[model samples]
Target chain A: MDDKVSIGMDSRRITTTQRETTRPFSLKRQPRLGESIIQGFLLFCGVLSMFTTIGIVVVLGSESIAFFRQVSIVEFVTNTVWSPQIDEFGILPLLLSTLLTSTIAMFIALPTGLAAAIYLSEYASSRARSILKPILEVLAGVPTVVYGYFALKFMTPVLKAVFGEANVNIYNMASAGLVMGIMIIPMVSSMSEDALSAVPRALREGAYGLGATRLETAIKVVLPAGISGIIAAFVVAISRAVGETMIVAVAAGAKPTFTFNPFEAAETMTGHIARISGGDLSYASIDYNSIFAIGLTLFLMTLGLNMVSRRLVRRFREVYE
Target chain B: MTTLNDEIKSGLPQGEAARRNVASRRRTGAIWRTIFLSATIIGLIALSLLIYNVVNEVFGYVATEYAVDPATLSDKPIDELNKDELVAVLQDNMRANAFRTLERDKPMADRSESEVYDLVIERVLKPQTLETWTLRDSWFNKAAIDAQVASEFPEAKLEFRSWLTAGFLTTPMSSDPLRAGVRTALLGSLWMIAITILFAFPIGVGAAIYLEEYATDNRFNRIIQTNINNLAGVPSIIYGMLGLVIFVRTLEPLTSGRIFGADSGNGRTIVAASLTMMLLILPIMIINGQEAIRAVPLSLRQASYGLGATKWQTIWHHVLPNALPGIFTGTILAVSRAIGETAPLIVVGASTFIVTDPDGPFAKFTALPIQIYNWTSRPQPEFAHIAASAIVVLLVMLLSLNAIAVLLRNRFSKRG
Candidate 1:
C-alpha cells in the first residue's frame, strides 16, 4: 500500500519546473494533513513506552496488593523464614540470599572488572584494545543459562575440590556467586572503560610532569576522576546480579535459607519464582501470588539501584562538563 | 653527600638505598600491570570455559543395556520398517496397556518412522543408560571406560554417541532423555521471535522517529527520554510479571485466541510470550533505532529540504534509507536477546516439558532457553547431556544473528 501511494505521488508531481530552480533556500512545502497524521502516529508510538511502564506498575501493584491482603506486608517484610509451601510468608531468607549472592558477585566482579577497564583505557596498546574489547563483550553475549550449567558442572566441582567435597554441597551459593560475578564482568569493564577513557589525557600528562609513574597516575589521578562512573558501573552490575535467575536456579538450590555461608545452598527471589511457576498452580493460589509478591520486591530493588546508577552517571557527566 | 659527589665525578654506581628504591618501585608497577592483564584475560577465559563446558557435554560415550534387544525379534532393518511394522513390534514386545496408552496418546498413524523407532527404543527395548562419559574422557580413557563399564554393567553395550544427533533434533520432549528433542522448543522460540519483531519493530522505529525528528526538547520529551533509558535497565523478570498480569490474565481473551476462535485457548500461549519479549526488547530497540536514525548525516536532510521536500518526505526518502542498515543491525541484536532469554518466559509460564510444536501465536509454548533450563535442572545426568545439545543450537542461532549484524554494519560502513 505504501509503495503504491509513493509511486503514485512521484508520477503526479510535475518535475520539469521544480528541477530548474537550484534554490539556496527551502521552497516551503505546504504542510499537508498527512504530515499531522504521521506525527500523531509517531508520537503515539513514543507514548507506548510510557504505557509499558504504567502497565508494569499497574499489573505488579494490583497483584502485589492481593498478595499483601493474604499476607501482611509488615510480617512479609520483617519475618525471617520464607517457607511458602507451608504458609510462612517471611521475605527475609530470599532477600538475604539475594543480598548474599549480589555481595559475593560484586566482590569478585568490581576489582577485576575495574582492573580490566584500567588496562584497556590506560595500558593496552590501541591494537590490543581493539582486538580484546569485543572478545570481552562476547562473554556478555553468552546466554545466562549456559553460565548456569557452567556453575553447576564446572565451577561447583572446582569449588568442591578447593573447599573439600564435604564442605561444599553439590548445589551451593559459592559457585553461583562466582559465576554470576563472571557473567557481569563485561558490563562492569565496558562501562568503566568508557568512563576511564573519557578522562582528560592532560591530567595524566600533568601527573607525569610531577614525576608520577603511569601506575601512580592511573590509580591516583585517573581513577579518582572516573570514580563516579566506576561507582555507577558497580551499581548497575549489582542490579544485574540481583536479578540474575538461571545461574542461581541451576547452581544455587531452591532452598531459601537465612544463613550467609557461601558453601550452603540457597534460593534467590528469581530462583524461587522460576521454581514455583514451573509447576502447575492455579491462578490466585497463595503459592501463585507469592511469586508475584517476590517479583514486586525484586522489581523495586532493581529500580532503586538503576535510579542510583542513573543519578551517579548524570552527576559525573555534569561535573566533567 | 661528599661520597655521592666523589662517586658521580668518578662515574661510579649509585648506593644500595637508591638502587633498592628503583628496583622496588619497578617491581610494584610490573606486579600491578600483570594484575590488570590477568583481569582482562579473565573475560576471555570465561568465554572459552563456557564453550568448552557446553561442547564437552554435547558428545560422549554411554553404557546402555536394553531389556530385550530388537535382534531377538523379527528385524528387516528397523530403519526400513513401516510405522505399522514398528507398532506391531512394540505391541508384541511391550505390555498391552502401555502400547495402547502410547498409541491412544498420539496415534501411530501420525507418528513418523523416526518417532516409531524412538518409541520402540524407548519403550520396547527400554535401553536404560547405565553410565556415561564425556567425549574427551571417552577417547583418552577408552580402556578404563571399558573396564569400568564391564565392572559396572556387565550386560550393557557401550557406544560412542554424539548427543546432538539427527534423531535428537527431530524428536519431541519426552520423559525419557534418550528420546527427548528440542523440536517443540525450537518452534516456540521461532514463533515467539516472529511475533516479537512484528509488534516491536514498527512501534520502536516510530518511537525513534518521534524522538529523533518530531519531538521538541520539551519537558514531555525529556520525560519520554528518561522513561526509555529507565525501561532499558528494568529487570526482564519484572517484564514477565507485567506479562503474566497484563497479557496472560488481563488480556486473556485477546492473547488466548478466544477472540479469534482458535483452539488451545490459554493465556500462557505464544502470544503472551511474544508480547512479553516485545516489552523486554522494546526499550533496546527504540534506543538502537534512535541511534541509527540519529547517525544519518545532517547534510542529507538539509539537501532534501532545499529541494522543497517536507520533513516527513525528507526523512522517508533520504534519512530512512540511510538509517535502514543501522536499524537492521540493532534489530538483529535485539532479536538474538529475545531468542536467548529464558527468565521472562519462565515467569510468564512457558511449559517445562511441552511436546507439541506451537502452531500459532495463541498456542501454548516453550522456548529453547526454557527447554535448556528445564533439562539442566533435572536430576538425571542424561537430561544435562541433552540440555547441552539444546544450548549448542541456541548459541549457534544467537551468534550467527550477531555475526550477520556485524557484517551488515561493516558493509554499510564501507559504503558510507
Candidate 2:
C-alpha cells in the first residue's frame, strides 16, 4: 500500500518538476508513521540512559547530603585519620589508599599490557595471534574473587618468600595491585590495539616508503595518529584500577590509613565498603551514610574520567579522519 | 699485452670469491619473525600454565578420593549397585594402600608401634565420608572400622573427596571443610543475577538507543555521555555502599517486611543487591549499545527517509535491525560483569549463611563468590579444595555466557 503511494508521488513529482524550481527538499514532507514508531522507541531508550545518570546523582547525592551535614567537609578532607567510629569520620585515608593502590596497579599494568599489545598487534604472526588472543581473554574472564583467593593462597606465599615474612604483610597493597594489573591486562591491550589498528595503513606505508623501519614508522607516524586513543585507553585503565575491589578486599587488608607505602596494609574506598557492609551497621545512621558519601566521590572521579576519555576519543578520531 | 695478464689474474681468484660469500639474508629475517612470534606464544603458554596449575591442584584431590584402586574392586564396574559402589571400592583400595605404606614406614610390635597396628581395618571398619558422600552411602560403620584398625594394622590417614563435590553446592558452610555447602550461596547468585539483568538491560539498552538515535549532539547529551562512561568506571563497591545506605538503612521500612517467616533482621535483600549491580553495569550496556548503533550504515536511514518515512520511522525500520548485533554484544558484556561482581554484594550485606534459598527478592541471600571467600579464608585446608571446585563452576558459567554472547553477535552481524 505504501509502495503504491510512493509510486504515485514519484510520477506526479516527475511531471510537475519538469518546469519546477525550489523542490530539492520536497522529500522532507513525507508522512512516515511506521518509521516514527521505531525512532520513538530508540529515543525512549536514549532518554532512559540519561535518567540513569539522574537517578544515580539523586539517590547517591541525597544520602551523601546527610553524611556531609553530620561530618564537616574539612574534617573529611584535611584529616588523615579515618576511624569512622562514633566521634570521628574521615575520608582522607581512604582516598590516599585508593590513589596509592591504583597508581601501583598502573605502574605494573602499563608496561606489560602495552608490550603485549604491541606484540600482538604489530609483531605476532597470525597463528600466534589466534591462539594468544583467547588465552589472554581468559585472564579477564576469571572472576576477581578467584584472583583474591589465589592471591591469598598462592601469590602471598611467593611474595613472602621473596620479601621475607616480616616485611611482606599478607594484606599489603602490592600483591593485590600486581594481581589486579594482570586481571586488567586484556582491557588495556584490547583497547590500545583498537586505537592502534584504527590508525590508517596509508600513514605507515608513507613512512616506510620514505625508508623508515617498521618500528620507526610505528613510533613516528602511527603512534602519533593513535595517541588520543592510547591516552583514552590509559585513562580508562586507571578508572578500572581505581574501581577494582575484590583483590584489594582480600589481599589488601581493611586498615584505612593515610600512607603511600605499598608494603603496608591499606584499604581503598571500595574495600572499606566491602568490609563494613560484610559486617553490620544500623540503617539511617551516619556511618551508613558515609558509604553513600564515599560512593559519591568515587562516582564523581570516574564520571570525570569517562567524560574526558570520550572527548579524547572524539578528538583522536577527528585528527586521523 | 700487460692488460690481458692483469685481467686473467683478477678473474682467477675463485677461492677468495667463495670465502667472501655471505649467507642468505632472508633466513635471518625469517628467524627474527619466528622469535617475535614465539614470544607472543610464550605469553599465551604462561596463561594456560596458570589455569593448569589451579585445575591440577584441585583435581589431584579428586583423583585420590574418586579414583578406583583396581586391586580390591572385585566386582566389575557395572556390578556395583549404585554411585557409591565405586567410592566404596576406592576406599577399600585406599585402605590396602595405607597398610602397604605403613608396612614400609615401620616394622612389627618390637620394631615399631606403627607396624603392629591395623591400617585396612580402620578405614574399612568406619568409612566416614564428607557431605560429598551424602549423595552416596557407605557399607561400613564407624566403630567397627576403629576396632578393625586396632586389631589389624593401625597406621593409615583416611582420605575423602580431595576436591569438593555437588554436596558442597547444597550444604551451608560449616566450621569443618567436610560439611560446608554452597547451596544458599548458589541460590543467592541466581537471584541477584536474575534481578540485575531484569533491571539493568532495559535501562541500559534504552539509554543506548536514546543517546545514539534521538538526542542531538548537544552539550547536555555530551554531559550525559560522559556521565555514563564514568558510571561504568566507578568502583562497584560504591554502589554497594549506596545500596546499603539507601535500601538497607533509609528504606528499611519498605524492605524489612516479615513476609518470609520471622523478621530475621536481614536488611539487605536480594532486590536491593540486584538494584545496586544494575546501576553498576548500566553504563557498560549503554556504551556497548551505542557502539552497535553507530555501526549501522546511514545509507539505510536515507533510503527509508526517501520513501516518505519520518525520522523515527527511518531509525526504527532501517537502523535498529542493523544494530541488533551490537545490542546483544553490549548486553552480554554488561551481564558478564554483573554476574562476576562480588565486592558490591559484600558491601550490601549478603548473608554468610542462609539455610534456605531466598523466599523472594526482599529475602537475604548469599552468593557463590561470598561462599567461596568464606571457605577459603577458613583455617581448614579442605575448604580450599571446595573453593577451587566452586571457582571452576563459576568460570564455566561465565565462559558459557560469554560464548552465547559471541554467538549472538556473530549471528546478527552475519545477517547484516
TM-score of chain B of each: 0.88, 0.67
What is each candidate's DockQ, to 2 decimals? Answer: 0.65, 0.37
Report candidate 2's interface RMSD in Å. Answer: 3.6
- Where's the lowest-lDDT run of ten residues in candidate 2 chain A? A19-28
Question: Candidate 1, B5: how far from true, in Å?
Answer: 18
Q: What DockQ class does candidate 2 belong to?
A: acceptable
lDDT of 1 by residue, B1-416 (tens): 99888877566336886678668877888899999999999998888888888888888899999988667766586667787888889888888898889878998888888889878887777888888888789869999999998898888989988889877777788888877888998888999999999999999999999999999989999999999988998888889888888898889999999989985756999999999999999899999999999999999999998987889999999999999999999999888888888888987889887788777888998889998888888888888799999999998898889889999999999999
lDDT of 2 by residue, B1-416 (tens): 89999897687545656344323234554564455455445446546645654564454311112222333445564333343453344344565676456446653223322212222223333333322221112124444544544555444333334355666666665554545666777788888899888877776766777787777889988878766666666677767766666666666756565554446475678877887788778778888888988898878888887887766666667787778777877788777788788887888788886677787787888888888777766655556667777787687788898899878977776786
* Fnat per predicted structure, each in turn: 0.78, 0.59
DockQ of 1: 0.65
The alpha-carbon RMSD values of the candidates against the true structure, listed in the order shown, are 6.5, 11.9
Question: How well does candidate 2 match the true structure in TM-score terms?
Answer: 0.75
